[model samples]
Target: MTKQIFKPRGQNTTRAIAANVFSLCFPLFLVDAVRRVHPVALQQFHLLPPDGADLAPGLLEDDPRIVIASAWIDLTDGPVVLHLPHTHGRHFDLTLIDTAGEPFASLGTRTDNDDGVDVAVVGPRWSGEVPHTHLARRAPSDACWAVSRIHAHSPLDRPEAEAVSRNQHVSSLGRRAEHRTDHVTSLEPPAVSSLRQVIELGPAVFFHRLDSVLDRAPIGFERSVRPLIDQFRRDLDGPPPVSSWSPDLAEALELGFADGLAAIRAATAAISESRGIGWHAVAVPQHDESGASLAQAGRAYSSLGAPAREELLTLVCEHDGHGRPLRGDRSSRLRFPPDGLPPVRGFWRLHTRPTASGDKRHGIGDRNDLSPDDDGALSLIIHDLPPAPGDLGNWLSAPHGEMCLIMRLYAPRGEALSGAWRMPPIEIVDLDVDGSRPGGASSESLKPNRRTPS
Candidate 1:
């Protein structure tokens, strides 16, 4: 005779139900974000080169070193092929992202050579044979995104970057090829401004969009979680119980979304203090402490819900090391001690921007005319004053009001990726100190050569 195993329901069952609800909805959150911007299509590419005065393509935190080629992709009908042109030793990457904004595959200098590659991106259900000469990658979801970045060292490099971008192409199996478009347009809606607006989306509106995307894309979630997804569908489709009102189910839906947002915030907050001094470093574990490993939700939330770690490693500072808000009222020094520079094959940059409004201030880094001191230490002085005689190579413009400083390391070294190295502290310099300056006069009268940190 066969025996059946059963366990009694525990007090944590409701909480488990709530957590499962969050995982189901998390991936759809980003999918809805894309829909809020553009109408659904098989493929569309934005081919404009970044002018440093405008936003890049799909996301925020753009840099001047790389020009972006972005597109929203759909592979429900057949396989999609991304055609990468030969970059001739320039650094570039074509990152393939899933519905949840987690990178599933990469084609670039790090993975493939700069000679360029033609990659055939297939969906989970695709079984047809791909060409032998082309690289083959299976995407987890039918709906995905591709961001292609080409290195542009300076204003003079824009022409070459544009030529390389113009040659790249994208096509589906047995279809006419689609090229990049030149016009610039805004696809993102104005209503979705901040993170709070995303979290505050009501359940019915949010889930309705989520359910629609799941209908088209098969993300191939783990087998254990499939039942919970089915339950969510049933809860939405089936009628409310005889004793319950329709509004009650809506309340539960809102509660689940709130719970998911809270969980994400808590996970990010737990790791916020690991970076020392006044900087916030970005990091995430490949697996949890239990060794069970993390799936899409954990990876998606790791960089505070960014696409991937390979995209960029960032350090943010709202205040100086001395706990003063970063402003032009007082000068600040960002000193790189001996052997403290970022280890990367690509490059590093530092710039400033306001948290609430206005464009980012003028940036500076190794890409510019920066040079080390006699002891091989690199120092950058930030203020609104004109560049002094000796300060021509190290002066960075800081907006006169409150602002933030960001350090971005492109193609960071393994040490940075593994969290083995930390950035040095940014020292605050007081211009009014005695004996520190040549004449010890007020900050307004001080020349660049006369200013020194205490």
Candidate 2:
């Protein structure tokens, strides 16, 4: 008996279109994973920091006072242990994220009370006996991402912060623990620069990398989006495009890619809404299936945004509490009473940025410009000019055009992280009539609902 085989050209074209769309969104999760494991840049379980002279080139923005301890782990070999140092009186946080960049566990002053621990991370397929002293956390994929934030109050704080950073250790389950101090490796600038470029590859090449990533990733990770991943792997894993190809198939793939990009933009926009006080807080921890797929794409294209929730809760304020744009044209004051300061064990600092893209402008808390009253309450002035006589030591200079304020509470107390405590508002102050004495602006004017100082 002989069987005849037939091809449905229209059906094949339709499937190809659908596969292209899935391929576009797949990168959102894969890009970060690929970047972390790229042999040219990162090594498994190697600890690296964003030293003053060495910033992750592709990152969108970074703070000068914070040093990041980053490492990428592959549990395929065995469980990897993360050993944190005892940071006395210092605030340090280490966050562990799964392949999807969702933080599943954390360690720090806020989360661990400065007492360090040795935790073991294993892959989903691992079956082994972890030591009783080791806290075992299973990762969703074979690869895990960890970023630790060590607070450096100033240039002087670097040495001590560096010490804490060096104390971090990672050991494969059965091997002797390896401290980061045991080896010295400099940042790979050229490889880091290529991160952004690789993410922008053409569809065919991009999907090829995506397939390689999915192959190594946890199969359960794709279960939710199984159809999408399967179809893409089947239809789009073939050769490059050519003019000789079917016109309808070519057009369909192009349209699918365009539609995928549009879907990602819209998805990111919807969830990117600022949660009052000009902050874009992450309200959703584990994203819905569709959202998770698209948001990863949005963040990948935008540069190194937040890789994970690394114990750092940041709030960006483009407008004052009174609904005025944060601008250099007008002056503003952020006052923190000795009794009502940010509930943090680490510390809190407010810095200004010219626009979202500009470097951070030096400010009060950073430079010791904060001025404290008799009651020890610190009040900082935000303006374009030099410090005024009455200005507290905390003088945050506003940007020339529209500005934004990032109030970062490192090692934040539970109250701050749980939304139980609210950051004080930025009060827009009217500059003195002569514009000579910024000191003339009284702290009393900022006392809410009453003329007298609180």
Candidate 3:
């Protein structure tokens, strides 16, 4: 035959190589797509204040706290769509507190069923007579729309059924009002508009409605989102110039992606390890006359860089002769003059728990009985056995050999970071013996505990 056919050489090999490259590039494309779409989706439904109203603070820190006095959520429509964009699996804790920060009263559960325990509603009054309402106490979901200011004493219908029936009622009212003969007759229910307002506004609107009650914005979104804006700007404009896309740039892109993935994995691991594991303390002794200046200490600590940073628990002991370096002991009690208290800002909380070793002979109170100082500083005694009347504040029942103290500073003020704020050291004041109390060992007399660089 006259025709010679030429078969391409390395066809399978070329195809295999192409497939591998595609596999690598495909994930990059997907990640970029996700990143682009996610922010857009979040922004689309971001809650905004009503026409002339001011924006409320978003959630702050991990634990979002808000104070609401009184407000009405107007769902102008009968049915509302509450979109919980950020809340994937977590439930919401919707609680109403009195002006004095006390729980108003027990309202029925927000969700009809107890399938989710994250979201809940607390009001002055909630009874079982209301339709589709549960009295069980639990949390609510991210997205929940409900009729606010419902007369707690009034017999209610099932929440879901009522929500539906309320829609019908509104429609009936509109029709009746259209044909009303007497101007004196009231054709519509008084609470209907308020309930409808909630339905029409959706989740974003509902959040804003609650924010109006406080005359402030939601705190969560502000903290989380504002940081990202700065980060994005820095990424786009700061430092080295961003390179343009090219076939030759693929290698660099892949390497950068690998580095980012590694960072994400490291962060995830660190978060997992730190949860409820106990406290970490970082102490930097001051030398200058101005004890308020943190410049020297801050620079010194920052020079050591991120690894040396310590997550402050709380200030246990301040200016007492309790000593420079604290001695380790088994007792849970602490004795200090009120004047030498550590400087704290915002809110501070203390927790007492047994050491990891699970020894019950130590002194420290369990979670229930932490006594705060006269100024809201936590003051309690530590002892193996229960303390006498004089040592009432000293009962810290910890394990026998060793224990720890955790101090949480929420919304720390500038002094906390600046050298201006100094946390007093925790000194071991006493330990329990065979049916008697013994004074605390001195830091010098006690065995030297190794000081790890924080």
Candidate 4:
């Protein structure tokens, strides 16, 4: 007797459409997740002051030792050349972010240009001869962002670093780029944007924007995804077409959008479990294929423009060793054992958020003038007040209300990149037995996890 095979009815009908629609919207949700973080104006290269004075909310990683010249770039027309004046002997790194909000390329002391040089960034669609003197880099996405970091060696070097950073400029290929309004961009509000808004835009708008951006710098993915994305592109676009499917299926679209968002959020929460003591570190994967997977999009949404692990490892501490949340109203101490400095070829910088008082403190890693204990351990007192009359650099300011610390390990290799080197816990000090007061270890502090900056 032959067995009968049962096939589901209308497998290629509404059910299939719904699944494809769901699949299409999930990744787009991640893309916009990256984009909403693209807050701040399209203003080119705004210089963040070393003291972090009048800081706006949502600054990811900032400090007194570095000056950042940040700007939003568009490659809709063609390739654009990023220009940096001669650095002479200053350490600098310029990171370019793609549409997915991932740092696709970096140029400066770590990669190339020990001194300085012109670098032309060409997208997938652009084809032209870059000037022989300029280094040409092929980018994965047309919509990009530029974040240039210049290190300030000392009090005397800040002004020079700021000047050098401000001198950087980007020139479009061919004729002067006449700004085109049709160029694709994220939700760029004068203020920072959240993920909810982007998700709310739903499948229609998100897919449209994705198509426009990919037109300039298309990233090819695997069979399962590439075909669906292309099908939607073709169906929604035409000379004479049934592309406008929104009005007819408005109700279905809304319901699907709501259900998809709820499902994705629940799944994401289960995935982002607390993994470390008090520090939360997110590293961009080495080969994150564009338009290929969910992890790449998720990384961009969480860490935004963070560089790859080989170049930098950013760690954030919002609490202390006792599982107590960090509060800005109190004080704390970050102690490092002798030979404890993160062993990296380039350098390491510790950033304290909302603590403007200790902006003038000396080098965080200048061991020559450091005052260490007999055990060779170094402890840096963090408070809103200044250190003693003639004490060598050890005081980091605490904010009046809230706080957190950001540590960047540049050129991380060996133990630092591996799980071997652990982050030193922040000692919550200057509190009473009941968690109130100032002076000594009280066991309470304001080091919220790395995200929004006050």
Candidate 5:
């Protein structure tokens, strides 16, 4: 008998991605997210209240505009019922993602349902009848996540958002169980549980973790690659197992893992930039090819659980209007023409992230306080330090080296989604201490998994 040799896969994402790399790379990040998924009380969301706002700067991507109520659910026990109280017209959305990292379904204001309804989520193996009071939501995997988002515009709307968040909850039918969603706070160090930690587990040890997380039969395009995973596992389980792998085979697997990681970290997926401002406006969870799993896993590591595209269209700006990479050391200005605010039924916000710089400060000021200038143009300045004294509330902050800005439209109108409307861009200006501005490459070296325009 002879051992099978694993063929070498393409290392470049610009070229065709190797099938084997897709199979191995896609599941690695999902297992990372699943490991952190825990249940929270029904209708209760984890957040820092207004008074505790000082502590929020330490958290990663902590958007104060929305309250999150999420949980890790499994159908092996039985079907579960998700309770959603009426929103009373405040924006809210709930997305259901399977263990394979696919977003299967979404519900909320985007779905045209302000009046709340109970949703019964069942797995493929489930054979029970959903009670007439609930809408049946069948999941691809037995293990899934119920991620809910409630609109909260800080100090004013936060109390109401918290109230609405408490009305949304998840309950399992078996054992009449009520799963608990984990409590997330700013006090905990993210490195201890971040998915990035799994990136260095190495192929052999990494595959074992992926195996434990494939709790349900693979579905969708994942089914096509399931055979390869099973064969690899069986090979390892046989007489020699991990020790039996030839050096050539071990090296090939290691390269495949690295290649897949590159694809994920780069977010090499096709991005249609809105007005070429380097803002990626994506309708996520595209399930056309095997790459869907890769995308889902990438989002899990970067975005985690975002609302459905219809309810919220998130635009991320990595570079400036000229397609030049945004630099934190250089100050910039973003000007919106008079009466040109983003049109939305719910609300809009521009979150300026001054990432993990030396000061480690985050966004300051709210989008609500923005007003037009004397000339009828609304200009917001971006800099590492306050542009002016006492007017800090009007400016945006940027990281010391790199820059990122997220613009969100809750309940966006038709024009915003269609090509009819486009957002203004950020232009780098002369604001260094020497008053000299320098321009360089088209992009920065940041490799966050968030998708960006090609």
Candidate 6:
């Protein structure tokens, strides 16, 4: 017997199963590799008024008025330029922040006669950090107009060498300060700076990887990728606060390579946990034209479009407790409801901040400013000021025109999403002169109410 020859029966079956799995998941791996290598490269530079430039005084630690100009980037091998004007006759600080609102770098300069400073940044390459140059104004001017030009170059190309030569030209712009602010009125430069040569490879890679992952991943896994990508972009291109670290090239390089990765990871976690259910609705009361009590308002308006129909208002019933919707409170701006709102064993709050145009600003407002009713229900009024004494609990100030409401529900029970836990509908009610509802007409009888200054 020539060494009994035998073949395994299940070998082919095992191989086939493995091949199928690999075929489904190979694209995701390729995409992930690309995404990891092609990170978002951003450079945002802007000028800000000095500490005491405004007559009303500088912004406090929490005020949103301190920002002047900002920019963002999401890819490498490109150049970005900003021409910042110095109109207030004061020296301005030029600052740059990555997407995480972390400071990247800064260049301080003085200007007179309105001639601003010029800043140029080069993205990283295979070599060490790319060299950047800053040219200080030759002479002082009343108002400085700074021009920024950013460039992105391919690592494969002679990016480092070319950047050096291009930087020389950028440096030359500061050689003479005699030119007036109107000297270069043309918004379009004759040629784009070399830094702009780099391409935004991160966005392309991110999408490609996302497509691959979705093909083989569970719905939750697939859904989480977007927030991660968004966070990556944001960390790479948002504004830093004033108290942040001073902007320097070394700091930016470190943040770009390190903190950027951290942001991506955090975003991935958030996306993974998100259930993908966007908005849900709860039941409330409906009213008739004569202000008579009618039927109950159900979940139909949950997805309805705004400027809501007459006799109907849809309040966001479920949200992460961050803030409540209120009308006249200024301190409630820039708050996010606590994450995940539902009817549970926790407390809830809601508030609203009036936009300049009377709409709600994105992602602002939380529970700290809302007043609760006698029965423990949260009340909100959309008027511009505190309602008369009795109605204070429900009065929220509305801008003169259109407005939005933000509500927060905290520690909501797990049953909230399934409708097992129900919250009373947010009713729109009319306030009498003394701020109390007359005749108890209910929320439906509330006419178009006004609470702002005459």
**What would the TM-scores of all predictions be?**
0.77, 0.75, 0.28, 0.68, 0.69, 0.26
lDDT of 4 by residue, 150-250 (tens): 87776578778777776776667644433332332222332424344455576556555655434433354332355655554454342123265655454
lDDT of 3 by residue, 229-282 (tens): 234324323212224434333343344333333332343334322223222333
Candidate 1 colliding pairs, count: 0
Write model 5 residue lDDT over 184-294, tens digit each, in one string: 331222433444455565666665555555545346535655565556545434313567877765665676666667766555343335534566774454333343444
State the lDDT at 380 in candidate 4: 67
Write one digit per residue (lDDT tens) for candidate 1, span 1-454.
1111111146433334444555544544544454345445535555533431122113454455466666677787789887788887777777777665556776587665468777888987789888897899888777677767787656577678767766666688656475654532323333443243455666545544555755644344433344456664564453233245365555555565666666665655565554434888655322121111124444444432232466567777877776767786467778777788887767778887742222233477776788675677777777665446556577776667777788877778899877787676666666656335222322333335444433
Q: Pick the candidate with the highest TM-score.
A: 1
lDDT per residue (tens digit) for residues 280-329 in model 2: 54322332333235555454433232433335556667788867777865
Best by lDDT: 1
Alpha-carbon local distance difference test for all models? 0.59, 0.56, 0.27, 0.56, 0.56, 0.29
TM-score of 6: 0.26
lDDT for model 3, please.
0.27
Count clashing residue pairs in model 4: 10
The list of candidate 1 runs beyond 4 A from truth reads 1-20, 48-58, 62-65, 87-90, 155-163, 174-200, 216-222, 231-247, 271-276, 283-307, 355-361, 434-454
Q: Rank the candidates by TM-score, best first.
A: 1, 2, 5, 4, 3, 6
Clashing pairs in 4: 318-447, 326-445, 326-446, 326-447, 327-445, 327-446, 328-446, 383-398, 430-439, 430-440
Query: What overall lDDT, based on C-alpha atoms, would model 4 receive against the true structure?
Result: 0.56
Q: How many backbone clashes does candidate 3 have?
A: 59
